[model samples]
Target: MATKTDDPKVLAQNRKANHDYFIEDTVEAGIVLTGTEIKSIRQGKANLRDSFVRIQSGEAWLINCHISHFEHGNRFNVDPTRTRKLLLHRTQIDKLFGQMKEKSYALVPLKIYLKNGFAKVLLGLAKGKKNYDKRQDVAKKDAQRDIDRALRDRQKY
Candidate 1:
């Protein structure tokens, strides 16, 4: 049995985003998709890597996110890398625009998933991490993994 905290069905995730930036906040926004595009997404053929969100003209847009063309789409398929608009409230757009003005801050797409039969994107308010920060994170993870291994060994004794 899956817990309520578990996600419904994640289509694609930008795992590198967590390592590259400090996510200050997350917002759920709807994505405007064409008919064939949604079909491809439903089949889990989507990629969030290299994708970023931009707030412009009181709206949010998703760039570089790829939803693969449906196998049967034929001539109906659109460009995989086409920019798509993100549906967000005016206030939310305003907030994102404000945060984006700060140095090194960015709007990034963390994950894409289906919710209540609609496609949603998890948008993050992120600040890029320095090279040293990434190295430190790796070292911290390695240390934590070692500690977990030690605990498991002790428990098995």
Candidate 2:
């Protein structure tokens, strides 16, 4: 019973991606989906939490993404964790392949959304963050929050 909106509606997001990696760039890519899969996504039954993008044989594939089976799909239901192909321009794919050659670089799916009634994924070119880097990010966020709080308090005085 999820309501469809005129604006693009996000179906799933990887909230941990930002905390675990430093995203350098992002690209919007189309995903290959079955009828049942699309139906399930429209109902907001999708998870990008543990999903990651991989390039093999010059093609990008989405792995570990979970798109729940449509309750009414019955025999049409596909595996929730099936590997889905991602569609990108030839140039874009080549660029991603080049960047991925570096050991530190990775491709991650940031979120999935409906754009113009078609499903799209926001893919990120990211570098993994170390434990210390994560701690630093947390500290910066806390400091920013404190500054905002002080500004709000000052406005009330």
Candidate 3:
């Protein structure tokens, strides 16, 4: 059971985005939500996995996000998986749109959190990594971990 706080404790994160995409930039945008949606989010019933940002008609939106409906709210509940509008400044929206025209550039949601009592999503402007790139990254991480362990052991013994 997750408790709602004024400062949002992260409920879910898209870890795959970090592994698969080279995040060039990040921007925080507020999410528009209804009462029930807000309640559900407070309960930690949200998924950022398989969710991404899209710019259309100069507006940014969060698509494919699953925010489960509030269990107690019946007829008053809103759609759980609706495409929600993202609140971003005009300049930021324009910049995002311009970069999105390039091939292989995409907008991925890194995480959703409550900031100052408002729901905010961290959007990443990223480029997808190739298979070899991922493998190289994994190897580098393994090597770094081994080096750290070796140094720690030497310091103790």
Top candidate by lDDT: 2
Minimal lDDT window, size 10, model 2? 1-10
Q: Write the per-residue lDDT of candidate 1 for residues 53-117, one digit (tens) a residue.
A: 87767778899998899999999999999999999999889877877885557999999898877
Candidate 2 vs candidate 3: which has greater TM-score?
A: 2
Clashing pairs in model 3, backbone N/Cα/C closer than 3 A = none
Clashes of 3: 0
Report how far residue 125 has shifted in candidate 3, in Å: 0.4
Compose the digit string of candidate 3's lDDT tens values, residues 17-102: 99999999999899999998988888889998899889999899899999998999899898778999999999999988888896
RMSD after CA superposition, every candidate: 3.0, 2.7, 3.2
| Candidate 2 residue lDDT tens string, 9-83 | 898899999999999999999999999999999989999988999988989999999999899999999999999
Which 10 successive residues of model 3 have the least lDDT summed? 2-11
Which residue runs of candidate 1 sit more than 4 Å off their true CA positions?
Answer: 1-7
Whole-model lDDT per candidate: 0.91, 0.94, 0.89
TM-score of 3: 0.90
Model 1 collision count: 0
Clashing pairs in 1: none
